[model samples]
Target chain A: MAQLRSLLLPTIFCLGGLMGNYFDRYTQSKNIVAEKASLVTTTDNKCSLGDIPSSAKEIMKFGFPSCENLKFREDYVLSYNRVHRTANWVIEHLTADKVFQRDFKRKSSMFKEDTSVPVLFRSTKKDYRNSGFDRGHLAPAGDHGYSLKALKDTFYLSNMSPQVGVGFNRDIWKRLEEYTRNQTRVYTDIYVITGPLYLPKESAEKDGKRYVKYQVIGKNDVSVPTHFFKIIVGDNRKKKSNAQLQLQVFQMPNEKISKGTPLDEYKTSLKSVEKASGLLFLDKASSLAIATDRSAI
Target chain B: MAQLRSLLLPTIFCLGGLMGNYFDRYTQSKNIVAEKASLVTTTDNKCSLGDIPSSAKEIMKFGFPSCENLKFREDYVLSYNRVHRTANWVIEHLTADKVFQRDFKRKSSMFKEDTSVPVLFRSTKKDYRNSGFDRGHLAPAGDHGYSLKALKDTFYLSNMSPQVGVGFNRDIWKRLEEYTRNQTRVYTDIYVITGPLYLPKESAEKDGKRYVKYQVIGKNDVSVPTHFFKIIVGDNRKKKSNAQLQLQVFQMPNEKISKGTPLDEYKTSLKSVEKASGLLFLDKASSLAIATDRSAI
Candidate 1:
């Protein structure tokens, strides 16, 4: 029971109690504040991708998160989730030269269906019509701006998420994209993973148990994530020996975010984002989980 | 004339051609891209304020700027400039506990005259009356909110700079203040110096030479600053040994700033802001100036 509580509650707090829908174990924990403390960070002052290996290892680099719908593009790799009709996460490797050399402007592109995904399971532009949500890019077109083909490939419905147009997509999220580009100016290289999060705010009590709640949208029943997460794995440019990676994670609400809300306010521990998303990077997944469980107990 | 051009051209490029008031020295020197390489940053991984002595020196620790008009308030120190009727810089040393432990709210206090300044040069609220500028804060009132007396002291006319009210003061500046507060969460301590800049843009070619130009406001002829700068000296919380301080400097136009503009866009090197403002900070003033001269030559 102690081991179960340790594993169950850290994941609950990591999901911020939003994962109660999947497990009743989250309902058993009453120490919400204490449990949330399980989130953590680890840093090594080295300048490489650390343990995730390289692009050549492809999808296996971060161990696929139980979802096999993977697409590897020229610049990024992503895993599509058939149930949600959105990419589980889009991963991209960015370098200073690659970002600075690009001078492309945003061009209009049709959100075409991914021929890669089965037609019956793929999301299309039709589902988003009049949904009052913007077809937000998980892997923003700006990151792929160096290549016309890469830029257009970002328009595929597979990379799109249902983002609120006004504040979240147009304002704060747009700023985050620019911030990522600017980081390239300082760091030699960085790996980025962008995805949607459907965590719940309130829990419904039913049959002496709690369940997480969220909303869905469109004919495809695409999930309207309660928040969005971006995880950055960075290599400090000055430190080239042993290739130690520094990590920073940000999770923002799916609501209106005011301008200049310091990025620090949204920064959460990378361990938590990994637990919530079930996606692992950097070779720390098993060790982080062990540490989380031990800390919880 | 060559010496003047050397000194003058460096300042012009440092201003990034924002000084159109100067001769087409900016346009003539088409190397705006190359000249900007003068911006340099030096870092020591030590965690404490270097060469500033220690906390026993308190506000005097950072070494005072040359202004004789100094205000040693309960929580902060400022070097006032009688000509502009604003502090050349408002200096504050902030810690996480002092900032976060307080629950104080912003209270409206009548802007009053500072009796400390000589009557001949002191500015008054009447000067700003019907003037199309907000009594912008150099050291934001928010930083002093912990003490009612300290908060009221911020209302003194001497601490105010003439700033555009809406977007510049109420939005971007406010965001910057909050961003500073947020930094305390990570750094053990940080020293902030906020001030205004009066640099010339678009040189006026006269008698085969150039001169800097600017505007003034109200009866007191308070010089309207073309830009504002904030320099932050931070101690990495984890590295406390030899006291290596990390530095980041920002300069912003005294104009309407759009919401969600990435902070990185406004980031300039410490060397340039020092050259533009002619104010020395830390103990690197002389060395930075020498470095600047070398880079220019």
Candidate 2:
């Protein structure tokens, strides 16, 4: 444990320093409390005007990816990327009770346009009809099975991305989602932020240049992300207020992955995800020490 | 003129209908007056805590493209795309006095990183170095020549994008900037919004897929937009309270164009630009009849 701590201390400090700068900028750009309160009052049915929803506050306890077009859902909060016709990021807070309840059926929910988004920017069912890609959920539907409304809210097209089917979305990506839900057994609370990435690769021309290339499907020209990322933070604060949290970040290619591949193969550093996605995660919570152990949960 | 109006009325009405929905969403998502007032007071050097800069109010009089990471400068307003390490869009309100008054020398200014942006998301000079692309200005420096500070503000890397050096940025793009500035001679006020686009092209693999492909330069991986667009709105309301405005939109590829090609050849419909860019232009001002004449200026 001492050896591991020695190794991880530098990374933790580095991230802590970087996040300090980011946290300042985030606060200056958007007043999170006021914005969240306003969003909850306006969009959420359970909350009246001037009343803040506890679900939104708990789900976004860490930090927001970007403060563009935000949607506060019943069980999750999302920032929509209008240009991509999909979510920039969707965040959810999961507990053992929420994941294990299974009070709702996924089959009962149907994918529909999020009318909260203007028609011009909203993704539709037709965009993915013959596009050969699945309407993959950013915030997996299984995680919000505690209530029917929560499960149905996950079906909004705004929360969907054009993800590869067969081996990727159905196989390995589903495994990741299952693994995330299972983590609720170990930690008191699990905070997860999932989003798409259009990463660059070295050009095939051998010209020493890198290019970001992605496909667009249908008339709306929805962007097919090159990869998807999930950053999971497991909080053990209920056990002891000062207990270190476990941080695990994964980046998987939006393509087929062989079965039996270890989930740890996709584990990545938080800095790389932040740099590529142009978002800062856990900035507000960086004051607390975070353990970087792969075997933690 | 009557024949042109008859042909253009449908497009205008369609855009008006579409924008009606968008304007409502825009207003709900962002209280333009409050946000602008807050942004001006926070960022502008000349303005005190409660004073809203008239410059920002005027430049963004029509509508904002996306209000993510907006930087309100002395002469222009920009929405920064942290993921791309470049400006998403920059809006500039030009007048005959501002464009014609050459108070600053181009050589006096130097391109530098925008310190206001968190260093993790900033685009540095090194990103453009040896990348075989020009540090092209979104809001042309020539238009801000009325003041040294305004000219210097244009040098911020936030306002720069990677563009083809010789044929595009130097020769053709320069001509476009010149043409935009020259328009101030004809119109009392010219509002121009310029930005990059990562438009998709039909896949070469014959898979019937469309792919958005762009190169990334240097360590920061600043995106090289596949195309660039400029939407110019000429307002003659000063002459009469309800005088019709002339609106022209152009999209040019980020590569070499034949030197003798006329600028009008790149003229495109506003709907096409809005669709490809995933942004609404002049949405708030849609109630005003806009002339679609290429020769209006």
Candidate 3:
């Protein structure tokens, strides 16, 4: 049974559940985890084609689910890239298990809470007043074909940003996806968060989604393109009391800061935060997973 | 019966079963999709305390049949997100008609090959490859708490890559896991190919498992540390006939090209196939679900 469990439930994250050294038989398999343990990961079931039924022609496909039903996993909160909670058993379906492989992996239990939490995909259909604003996805759909819910979740109002798909297809957005996934080859267990900045509601919506009118970033300016990054130190249910905690790193064209020709166009931008969370990246993130853990701080 | 099948089997790929939507109904509620399909996502089956079964406190906290063993739908592919596939029934469980709500999901039609595949756990203690290789993971475990098979598949050799886990932590890993799912959110049918780049003469091996090594990107770099990518493209498969067509993608990061800032430091480092096998991102793709629609590309 233990061996079977190991074969069935392959993972090394017992710091939250069950990680076997092979000598021991245990199945520390749970969707949400909190306790004193460690984890190890592998890609045993990474990618392979599934057996198609004789009715392969008859099997139909599903589209995305709804915003009202966008269930957020209480797992980890968004740290960098996009707004995200710890993944749930269901979100696992959004992954391309049979296509890509985890070429490399490493983790830091030494993470700390920071101000910028990257909101990846929330309910794009909902808003901040906790109103009808849709949670937009930093990532887009028509990209992930896992399910109507998973794919549609990518289309959530919260997941929305008013940008042309062609813009993404052409510039940084397209490069970003290819760079991260296509090039890096990372295939699992990553937390992300990406959302828009609110300074007196520049864009509003009826469905409560969002009106992404502009970016805080500018071109050719040294201090151009100032974006916020929130390094979530914990899970979504239990987050730091406020958004002040920040490990916010500002992004700008290097030409501005460093010596370069045609480098005169540089304007540094500033973003205000209620408070600032200390740096968490280069240290202390592993312990937060166990113990009583935490609850939406 | 069509409506029943609509609710029962959501696994068919429409583009000759290549681009069929990949969704497992059990993962998320279709009603949410019917309601908020425009944007945002609502799922009931996101990972949670409920997933920890009450029967086994140590092993199964999220709970279950000790562990859930699943057979690939006739397509051999399994959708754990908001979609699930069944022949002619939408039974949530073998014994119950209850539905499941999942956060992320992968709607698939690629399962046209195998019987139920085994989801394995943990890297083998022994590296048998003697090629300085390690059974790397293709899928990271953090993303798929939703699907046990997704997690276990990370352990498969087919998906393993020679990588070093640094800089990338669980938070990022999880985000990347979800990101990969989202990245693959397109193409009705996608064929991914990956494997080791080379076999070193004196590589280490333990328990029949090889310890693969990948270069450290930013760990040593001061100005721009951790800047590298792993990938290989072009068709490398032995073909039986010229008539056979294949979808080739740069699956994993091979030491040959997957280790540097290819885009920045190495221009012309990337390759273009002139014409991709199919349309990549079709804005509002559903309208083009049919091959003959011809609005995209």
Candidate 4:
């Protein structure tokens, strides 16, 4: 009986691996179709809207975190959080073709309210004025420098969150964005999902209770997220059909980080981010090749 | 010239009133059809599911707050907030027939996890067990005493929030629920929408900044809302076609409340609740019959 069981184990493992690969491909294709359909609808709404690019389809090849108030832009897509007057999450597809092309300058882009959103829920420039915190971009402006419209779209208040300036947004957060862009040189395609998080912290009173606290800036009451997260997927599609996809998840505190702090220290598991953000990541990917080895970072 | 101006003023007022009434009826009928269609889909899901009751249709006469994760129950319908492990809002259609029927007793109902919700986001009875807060029902069980299944449905953890037990949930909150049921005697139909709110409060440091803070309980991290809100719309449908509809909105803190404090003190404008909750109320209604006179309370 022991010999028979051992013989069956190998066969079962082979079948499971085949099924996983098949399912992953099926899901990837299904998501691409759905995303393309949505982009088509967006194109129909605006006559001047740019052509639907295949890059958008490849970016959302895995799956969407959540489908609510989705704004399909020229270079990226974001789900706006109407209540918080900010984005729930933003998806950006990075490649050597787009990130390397620098046709537009950031100087001409202006921060403006997203007129597509209802006036009642819209966030404005006045809300961020004198509010000490910087209007941080979720889809970094530098990533969309390939097109003038895409660069300007990143400046919408809907894409902005109230982020700390000196030590956080401008310093460590910028480094992370640059690091993500640098990966385009290594991987053929890079898909990124970035969003804010309101995490709970254990109270100081030792009352055995946890509390979530975050400041609201401006009249719109835009929530200053306690933390921010990014999930990066690196795919080398040119490789064999069974080529592994590299996954890396990072979560950073909204406050200041010392200059010497290693970026690897912020790395976290995908499950932790999903639980905290109330969002699921890459569910369509039957198997995630999480770069568990520290050397991968 | 004075005579002409006075005549035009009255004519303009009359025209505005006519348009408002016509628009209100048109919107109301549209909502009814949309809600009925949704109920039909819910019915098709489970063969054993209870029949589609007209009460559920009447409860949602005003359009839904937001359509994300909706759970259509026997007597009440709610939009579940998967992130918070609680209902975004629960709507109950109260009437002289349902609330006063007393066909089911509360003792027979048991607090159980809602299996309909995904296991990752579901809250359990264990989460509330020693959590220092009561499993307060957003749709009060007493409001569904007419049917055994309806009463038991209210016990689902999805319908609960971590509410203060003694001074709040049991004492003042109970009174408010009872008060809502009693309104059925006056109005032919009383539609109540109850939900939790994490309202922002100004900090004590005089820094001129506002913050939202709330406690979370157990492994599931079910949010303990800082406040609760109810929007009560009373309609006397039996009256003339142009009869007015009463609108009353209230918001209460999640902490303790004194016994002597009048419930009227909690009454607030609908606009304030909408702004804070990130929801719209009765947008389909042509005009609100706001009981401006304190005597109406």
Candidate 5:
């Protein structure tokens, strides 16, 4: 186990944990814009597990609701551990844990929500396997720097689900990640919405064993992700009845016969790190896009 | 209908008509690059379709490849126009009809390859009735200030596709656009690759339609699009190529459970225009990108 650092300087500045408290008080009695913290001190800025405890905002959940039971899918579970300011929810067996640290450049794209991300999977140990599914990784290590934990969390069997790489290997997936990173500059925090997208069992596959792979993927033929999620961390102060930045991550099945995915392409992304994660987010991009649309008017 | 300007001056400068000659000469001779104009006609440059028809090197198609036949299914159609320009290809939409105006605050980005561009949908008709789906736009108008024809061509029924907004009212969408405009000074000709993403049927709908929508979009949703292809207009040449930039837009099945679209949401999109004719060359982004990718790789 790697010893973690305890830097909170960026946390305070980045998360505005202190400001989060101030906003709580400020909104309490219309206290203007709340007390302004000219600067964040390392003291209160640490990303304590307390910050994201069970009570923490379940802002977004991917995989199955049952995965939320924690114990049910302990194998794929990534617990938040503080290495100073960085909170890493780690895994142990990524689909391709070893290929993560290379200097492979992602394709140019408008968004890279899931480029370079590690594929996760659903664990057979969790009773969610064999129904024709795949283990998908919600928290991908490929996009972020190479942290041993980051790589491991990618393989957390519980995090896996059946998924088709929408723009996988292509640029769309990488561009989405870039888009999310860009969001950090303007917003105080970012809440991401990501999950696996399953396909019908008979959509398409290779020799009935290999699934259609993506470009620029790991040793496993899984296409590098083509999509990711991004919900800028906004002040949850209002606890606004509606999600401020809700998003969805999905893997689109290849529609036409020649787009590369063979006919009889698996409608459902497979199961098993050996197969595909038979999982997908509850909704698709359109479902979550409504979150941004204000119904007030 | 608005009569388009002569565009002759730009036509000569951009080498709009010389596409055919350029293709045989340039395509056969793989070592060619877009020639830089020596004349100081620094008529401020912005993103435009001027360079597309003659610039592409490869035309790797994404999604399911279908003939001109068959009804378009938002989730079962092409996913993107992956263009490889020899080490890079800017992913963008081209129209058979000239439309859109490149208006940006700087030159570098406008001149650079596609960087960030969002997928937009323009209805083929005003009323969402009759059409089995909502008119969708692939290249959104928000990214550029194209001419009416430029904008209109983008709304070609062939250009629209099913889409879903990805975030809150996609407030981040516009912000992302602004961010791209602001970041131009830092990078230029950012090779881009953007396209439609099929999430699934009823994947996630706004009111009742499943659409892929976004707040911010870039020219090439990637850090660096691999297959690079481009063409330079030498104020002389003949137009060539038959591949057109097609926009496949789509919307979801309307749900009475949803309120009427907001008045502010009323738009003058491409779907509302009459059929187009002429030297249709604008709708050619994906094709050119494909050429660029092919020649380069």
Candidate 6:
């Protein structure tokens, strides 16, 4: 965290709770021009969520975890958190064709304010401008390689969460995303739900009781999650019933992670991730099948 | 030009002509994955060039100046020149609404090979990798604010010409682009033609006859233009006749230009740019009207 202090100035000494009112007003009207311009043209030939397979949609309902201020786009959807000024979860379905695409080059730029969000509650690029944390994408752009617009939509600030840039974002987290896409080779299509987790840990205590503790960055007090999670449900179209569905859940810390670490080492049950984030995922019917057919990591 | 030598090796000294066969074979297969991925998704409901107003279309016919292997996208069109490994010109029609967009951030990356062009003749980012010159966009991404996809399309290597980075690309040329966009405040829609100029001067002579002398960068032999040109045609749709049509043509040297220099100082005639590039623009019918009703610079 000393590196964090070096990169940021603790100019506003008040607690995160104290800046809510000011943050509300600032995000409401800031950067309107840039955000609005992109919205108008992006809607062309957008694919509707109705196109989402019903079985995949069923899992998405619970996996979203927190539905506060949910936002929808043709390629993906999310439940946004005005308090965190970031997404609670971003959900998308990646088909085999999307995973196979390699045409468009990545557009690497700073994250932008997601104008599609209600102005008062939207996050601004300024929130992370000089803040030490990288604006990491919960719904990775590399997965949407099939469509340029889908890839561009991923850049919207609402899809981003603050995460360590060096070892975490550029290293382990990136490898995890690549691994997820690589799984597309084995499944016909995959439904993904990715979000941050702020769970109670022994390292931080408030009022002599251990509680979940994380740093809040920028004027908006965007909560930096202690860890992040990805819940994946893969569809094996060849099977007749839900029996063929494959579920893989992973949770990783928001800290330096070694490059060669096996992904199986970080595997966790959906039930565990749900408890930490306090969000339900998968209905009992689907959960029962997963429990019976679960494969050993 | 001397500054360029400092940033690039003066290797393969025979001439720009010597490596044509090698460049032809290499660009054909290099970076196949990145370029091919984008072409698949970009074809969604593309806006046709026929949508351009008759008057604007007439002007574009010549401003594209050459119809050889013309490439068309939703927002703009250009004629690809295999020898130069860049567009002879990129022509676009911009409305007031477009000039005002500010939402999306610029994607900063090195030039990529344009897959839309014939692979054997296209330019690659590697050509400019250590060549010291910037892969400057003939069609500035800033002007395509109306659509993020349009802005992204501007990144294709076919639309780029090698430019001096610091003083030219960053300073004067950037300001000129801003000036052009600012004109949107007065005109309803504007037609723009921008490209490189490989004009011969008295100083560069062979056999006492002036010959075009320009540097070739990288192993690909991508030609570096000595100057650049921009021809803008603005239409005041409110006016019923040709009285509303306004044209401004400018030519700037590919060297350091002071920020404070007045734009009028660079103003030239379309005929001059046409003669130097050996391309005809604004066919006889439209040329007659521009000559008779040309506005003062």
* Collision count for each candidate, in order: 18, 0, 226, 0, 192, 8
Write model 5 residue lDDT over A65-132, tens digit each, in one string. 11111211212333211100011222222212223353433221111122111112112223222322
Candidate 3 achieves a global lDDT of 0.22
TM-score of the second chain, cand. 2: 0.81
Give the TM-scores of the predictions, in the order they appear.
0.39, 0.83, 0.20, 0.80, 0.22, 0.40
* Per-residue lDDT of model 3, residues B3-54, tens digit only: 3443221211112222222322112222211210000000111111112222
Instruction: Give candidate 2 regions above 4 Å deviation.
Output: A1-52, A291-297, B1-52, B291-297
Residue range B25-121, candidate 6, lDDT tens digits: 2224333111110000000111111123343443353333443335665567776665467777888777778767855556643356777554445
Off by over 4 Å in 4: A1-56, A288-297, B1-55, B288-297
Q: Which stretches of candidate 3 lie over 4 Å from their true place?
A: A1-136, A164-170, A183-188, A198-284, A287-297, B1-297
Q: If you assessed candidate 4 against the hidden native complex, which CAPRI class would it receive? A: incorrect
Tens digit per residue, CA lDDT, model 4, B92-171: 88889999999889998999988766666789888998999999999999998889999999999999999999999999
lDDT of 1 by residue, A1-297 (tens): 854543442232234222212211102333221222111111100111112234524423333332224565667777676546788888887777766666666665567877655443567778788777888999888887777777777888889888988988998888888889788876777778899875422223333222223344555455566689997766553556444455677899878888778877888876466545544344422333224332432
Chain A, candidate 2, TM-score of 0.82
lDDT of 5 by residue, B100-162 (tens): 235422222221111111111111133223322333333444443445333333333333332
A189-250: candidate 6 lDDT, tens digit per residue: 67788999765543232332233345666545566778999988777755555546788899
DockQ score for model 1: 0.01
Task: Give the lDDT ranking, best first.
Answer: 2, 4, 6, 1, 5, 3
The C-alpha local distance difference test score for the whole of candidate 4 amounts to 0.72
User: Among these predicted structures, which one has the highest lDDT?
Assistant: 2
User: Lowest-lDDT window of 10 residues in candidate 5 chain B?
Assistant: B38-47
Candidates in order have lDDT scores of 0.59, 0.76, 0.22, 0.72, 0.25, 0.60
- iRMSD in angstroms, per model: 29.1, 20.2, 22.6, 24.4, 25.5, 32.1
**Candidates by TM-score, descending order:** 2, 4, 6, 1, 5, 3
Q: What is the lDDT of residue B141 in candidate 6?
A: 83
Question: B1-297, model 1: which lDDT tens digit per residue?
Answer: 853432342233224222212221101222222221111111100011112223324654444433233465667777666545677788888878767755566555668887665443457787777767898988777777777877787788888888888888888878888888888877887788889875544234333222233345554556567789988766653556544566667899988998888777888876566545544455432333224332442
lDDT per residue (tens digit) for residues A176-276 in model 4: 99899988998888889999999999998998899999999888898999999988888776655555778888999999899868889999977788778
Least well predicted 10-residue stretch by lDDT in candidate 5 chain A: A39-48
